[model samples]
Target: MGVCLVLIVLAWNVVRLWSTTAAVVMSVVAAVLPPIAAVVANWGEDH
Candidate 1:
């Protein structure tokens, strides 16, 4: 859900600014954050 929000904002900015660099950077972040967020959110819960 949080990841979705980030992607949505990224899309909005990409569309609004039409900047390739911003798109690429946001795309990288959008790709990377979900797994990281999941790991952080679930860290140590199985103990």
Candidate 2:
């Protein structure tokens, strides 16, 4: 996520009008949720 943000910032700096904000947002969500989902799935498997 930090890398994505850095890329976005670099692109914005280079192009000054890049439209990858959604990609950055999606990358952040994609970074955070899957492991949480996996843990929830594992916990539920025992119950």
Candidate 3:
């Protein structure tokens, strides 16, 4: 979560100006992180 937010903030505020493609890729990676985190968090849990 924290990492995701940081990535997004950097992507928009810093990386975008230098390279839109890199920024978009970072944003996409940030977007995917939460759900992956959720799945990892729940993995092997008993519900």
Compared with the true structure, what per-residue lDDT tens digits does model 2 show for residues 1-47? 45556655565565445556755665566566667777877996765
Instruction: Provide C-alpha RMSD values for all models, in order.
Output: 2.9, 5.3, 1.5
| Model 2, residue 11: C-alpha shift (Å) | 14
**What is the Å distance of residue 36 in model 1 from its true position?**
0.7
Per-residue CA lDDT of candidate 1, range 1-47, in tens? 67767775876665448776766766777778888888999999999
State the number of backbone clashes in model 1: 0
Error of 1 at 14 (Å): 3.5
Q: Enumerate residue pairs that collide in model 1.
A: none
Clashing pairs in 3: none
- Local distance difference test, per candidate? 0.74, 0.61, 0.96
- A best-first ranking of the candidates according to their lDDT comes to 3, 1, 2
TM-score on alpha carbons, each prediction: 0.56, 0.41, 0.88
**Worst-scoring 10-residue span by lDDT in model 1:** 7-16
**Candidate 3 ranges beyond 4 A from true positions:** none
lDDT of 3 by residue, 1-47 (tens): 89999999999999999999999999999999999999998998995
Tell me the lDDT of model 2 at 28.
64
